[model samples]
Target: MSINVFAGSRKALVASIALAAVLGSVTASSAVLAADALSTASTTVTLSAKINGFTNTDWLNGVWRAAPALSIPASTANNAAFKVGASVRLADGQVRKVTKVYVVGSNLSVFLDGAVVDGNKVGAPNVLSAVTIATATTSPTTSSPTTSSGSTTTVSSGIAYASGINNFTNTDWLNGVWRKSAGFSIPATSASKSAFIVGATVKLADGQLRKVKTVQVVGSNMSVFLDGAAVNGSVVGYPNKLTAVSGSTTETAITAPTQTTLATSGLNNFTNTDWLNGVWRKSAGFSIAATGANQAAFKLGNSVKLADGQVRKITAAYVSGSNMSVYLDGAVLDGNAVGYPKTITAISGTSTSTGTVTSPAPSAPVVSAPAESTAPADTTNGQPRLVGVNLSGAGFGPSVVPGVHGTNYTYPAESYYKKYADLGMKLVRLPFLWERIQPKLNTPLNATELARLKQSLDFAHKHGVKVILDLHNYYRYFGKLIGSSEVPISSFAGVWKQIVQEVVSHPAVEGYGLMNEPYSTNGLWPQAALAAAKAIRTLDSQRWIYVAGDRWSSAYHWPHYNTQLINDPWMRDRKNNLVFEAHMYVDKDFSGNYFDKAEVFDPMIGVNRVKPFVEWLKSNNLRGYIGEHGVPDFSPSAIVATDNLLAYLRQNCIPSTYWAAGPWWGEYALSLDVTSGKARPQLPVLQKHAKTANSCSSIGPL
Candidate 1:
């Protein structure tokens, strides 16, 4: 018998063979040669300005598809900690053994037993995954069993047994013929004189097992009840090669098996500082401050300590077909992997034919309905809530675009919208660059540009996703600020004038984000925001207009009394239709530049950080939206922070959208792409929030 295994490199594979010899070799040599190569190890871990958690299912799901390589950054000092044969866990909960370790330039790469991570060099976070150092590495010793069966071998009770051929004097099957049977009924006795009881296990000639639901014997006519119908056949006088098992078997009512699944959120807690300096210890508790990485583990319906050392129980966990849910105090916590792996492996035991029979084939309906929605139900009213991710490809090109930037952007297919729709997403923040809308100043919208944008909007609308056309230029145009004399505010407004006319009344076009992350230091951003808002208002008065702040539209900077753009008088008009927008990122410095924390549990950083901005909107009776916020792909703290942020948003009836979910963010430090097509450690968080906030009260009429 042969089993397949994955390793990081040839050398690692050799080490794996040695490790397997100790672990009692589960895989063959052919499988050992299938090790995938990873990038050679380098000196440091790569650092980038990447956020986490928020993933878009449209462009790419979170599943990791390619071979994985370690992209160790030049700054990482604990290179010795990671070695061939070390145990590591991927973001999707799969544990793998390291095969080979490579050092190329300043980066470190390796091969894993299974390649669950992406193998990219550019822009990817080059950090080793969570590692489990064995206390004392030792090899396995193989052993074999020797036993013999006696005349009367004990049939151990509670032990599962197969029902092919078994010797039992009490339980014996005699040949029987088909007869015209009616209602299900138990026979008084067997034709061979053995008791034909209801609980007796009987196997037909084809090896299918069925209990006597209601066996009937009418003058040598016999009927076996199964599948809610009775089988009619004539009873045979003798057991002619016909078999039957004595003991009953019960496989249903089994809970899913316990498996150690890891979430790719937080990096290794025991890093160089902790390992070399011997300062890894922290106050043991549930809070992020108290607990270090790998200190705890959980699954659906499990319990764990909170940041404050408070033991909290998982309120609910249930799997229905493909949909699985996990609740904390009745509120949904995102990232519950339901139906991915069958929780309960069917166990064979004694059968109990207590009236109702288990499905004869032992297979329940895997899918409740074809194309049934896994998304949450629609809101009470007709208007649906706008809970979704952003699609970010059209805005990828040159920020200062007089010089051409790369044009490798591709429009998403209709399948993308359908994918999100299936996940209960009703809103999409579609970001396209101003350069694409107008290649040169005062030029007509390009034919390809219009068609592509229109195609995206049409497809999204057709699939029930509302579109939010976002001009993601950061308030700059070809190296010129919007309000600067070089590119007057009118030029920016003119672009909207063309765009607004084209999509003003489209049913799917819910609103227009004037600009993404405007960072104008001067007071030019307020003027730019108003210019675009008024331009759109002229074309359509009722549609919502989103206006961002000056300093990157940051939530931390939104309420700065002196520089805040939301306080501008021009933004107060059409109050109900105008939504102030701001973005938030949580780290030690309130920037999404690093992913060092194992988890984030502080209300100060998670909820308190955004409280001021949300409160400002409430005090002014203004509605607002979180235009962008996301956590890292491999941090538990990121997940906690994102959940806290979203919970706060929903509690205050504020609507928000997650940042940069498109497939273009390959290996970006904050990408949620667990795979090329599926998301992990992030999608569950999004789904949990979407399903919990079932009310569309936050979203007004279109």
Candidate 2:
């Protein structure tokens, strides 16, 4: 699996937490001060200038640059008259609290809370009105305290105060309540030192009130619980202020929004629309009538105008309840969820006359093989002649490089080779980390790792399975990407040269996959792949060389990123033994994780995604292969999609390998491993399409 795919869900969750902290703050209090009462000094300023630009500083904050640079008081730390935690009103009449105050080369830049709009966290340029700053006053007021009989008197105030409020960093939205993580300090100087009891109410910096639920003080730091999540547009962190409100702690009842089923008919006659909350709905208008079986009007490939007024064809459509959602050309318009149809200006190719249209049945398309003139004379009607599964265990545990052989990561057992070969699978794509094979860049291959790799090749040779040596590194070695000063292209080429020198004569070695999925921001993968291929050619010119494209080698994006490989003269192989490799997945994120059944909403998803790559190969007369593709065994729709995808590949004479079969993938949804002598659900599908022809000789002229 792609590392990016594995970490996609985690990255999203972290972003949600950061967003909540910026939009609102949780209030809880503990301890009280007995010393003289402290009063805070504050100042307010109004500016009539409009915001000319906005820039995002980070996930939780952004800077609003005033037009023509507004002159304001110095915002340095010593000048507490104007600093962070200041509240400001925008020209649009919206109030926001400042998180940072700085000058960008004489232009005042006020950093404030940020919100996500159109799938990105960005600041909107608005007019500036006023900014208010507050500072603790130096002067103090004395207050007398009551004393017990015959005991020394101690000064105390009945009000509670929480100090070190600025140190609270993390926030979470739990049970509809936004809460600050524990470990914040409460100074023991206030009069009512323990007034932060349960059921107490405290007011946050933004003036929003919250009720206390639990209070636990561990030494100086206290963990106090608050009621209710952060309100939208509320600021989280305040520099030096947290005031306890004196009142009864009565909880407010929150009402849930009512769920209503809207109409889905007359969607083809939309006037205006917008994509919001991962669905396309009417921006402003009344709901249309509900769509029944007799009134269905939209099909899979009808062209319609979106909110932006651009016409796009619908690739998939389905109705859930009374709302209908459509996907345009397989594009994930907003996350994985499809768009709910709303009012639009026009929709073409569907008859609205009689209010009756045919809705496409959720079934796989019948794809026929096209005649291939470029195929060799012996090619069997352009059918895919090689099918197999990836033997994936040596690539696990990437964090522990050069780890223990079996405990951290292991190689596929010899029995796997015999078992798969007996099932008519003659190809095996073996994934191994480059760092494990060559521990140090531009250095000799590790003896133990090299020996272990050779043993797998020997097993392949014994079982008559052709092996593709796949370097399962994502264009990096030890966290450093290729083409960087630390890891140059020469180092990448050097490793391939050494690998080829060791395994060139092995009969099972069908090809050398330079890299598994080269995703780099420096745009140097094409050059690095060309250099690696040249290095391997110098050692052995007959073996095929497979070059994977950037962006995880996604088949859907092959034409956009890999067309340069076909046009560049330096990338040409003298022996014509080069093959392009790409990967495809039916899931919405293309991660191949398939955590949800809705990911495979359309049965023809696989065929639609791989069409571009297949067309690119046929049009350019180039040899192409699918290096990785799989579907979860639990989803029947996903299985049908996989079958359709394999059938399309066979028609186009392109081979593919299932994502995996390894001893370590226990309970993995895509694994082909047998459990308790019962075959996995996806195993029969692979067995039905298994082919053993010499793919290299059969696809193109040799």
lDDT of 1 at 47: 23
**TM-score of model 2 vs. true structure:** 0.46
lDDT of 2 at 457: 83
Which candidate leads the pack in lDDT?
2
What are the runs in model 1 whose C-alpha is more than 4 Å off?
1-380, 383-386, 399-407, 561-570, 595-604, 674-679, 694-696, 699-702
Candidate 2: tens digits of C-alpha lDDT, residues 221-284? 4444443322321253435444564432211111111112122233433223233433433111
The local distance difference test score of each candidate is 0.45, 0.53
Which lDDT value does model 2 have at 672? 83
RMSD of 1: 28.1
Model 2: ten consecutive residues of lowest lDDT: 361-370
In model 2, the Cα lDDT at residue 290 comes to: 31
